[model samples]
Target: MSSSSSMNKYWIPHLDIHKKVITQELQFYLGPEATVRSFTRDGEDGFLITTPGACLTDEQIDDICVKSKEMWEKQAAARAAGAATRVLKRPLHQPVVISKAGASESTRRRRESRRSNETRSRRDERRRN
Candidate 1:
């Protein structure tokens, strides 16, 4: 077997969900030395935990498995706790639709009022003069 292939068989790293791989966010969080071997969707919504691999002796691999499991369990617990916590949700406003509907109601009222007041004032000044 090729050296790389052999290395993969013993120390290959990958992560997949059923078949597709996970995002870079999960990979970086796993640390540089960890290689994501595969991932399985955790629930109906497709939450996932990626499996990782590393090059190690048999003993080291065993220790790593234990440590990795601990880390994952802690992370999962933290996630569950966070999810249970209440958070304020902000409303998103969609874009307003504009049309050639002339001026807005307020603007039109203001302009009409201003013009009427000016006309009345001009008439009163003429009468006084």
Candidate 2:
């Protein structure tokens, strides 16, 4: 049998796993001869999985790539859904009132009331002085 040192290294990017369960899953999928190693570079983590004599066939590689893409897409969709729910739950930071052509009746009434209050306050101030 060939030594472990003679095995070929295959680098798979963005395969960082913190959980032992995930590591076990990868190991199980990769088969017994494969050895998986993890590394971090420039704040990003990746995996370096080794196999003897190109153990993975082209079809296996294609399947792995497809599954990885599907997983990422699902994760992205979930995050987007969560963000949308959060946006719906939270109150508006700035309430926007959009009207076409002229102001609405309620808006006009509010402006008139504000003007009357300002006039009354000024008049009261003058009378006091």
Candidate 2 contains a number of clashing pairs equal to 0
Report clashes for each candidate as comma-separated counts.
8, 0
TM-score of each: 0.31, 0.46
Give each model's whole-structure lDDT: 0.49, 0.65
- Point to the candidate with the largest lDDT: 2
Q: Tell me, what's the RMSD of every candidate? A: 13.0, 8.0
Per-residue lDDT of candidate 1, residues 10-118 (tens digit): 2223312221223333344444433444423333233333233443445543444555566667779999998898464743554556733556767878989999999
- Residue pairs with colliding backbones in model 1 are 14-36, 14-37, 14-38, 15-36, 15-37, 15-38, 16-38, 16-39
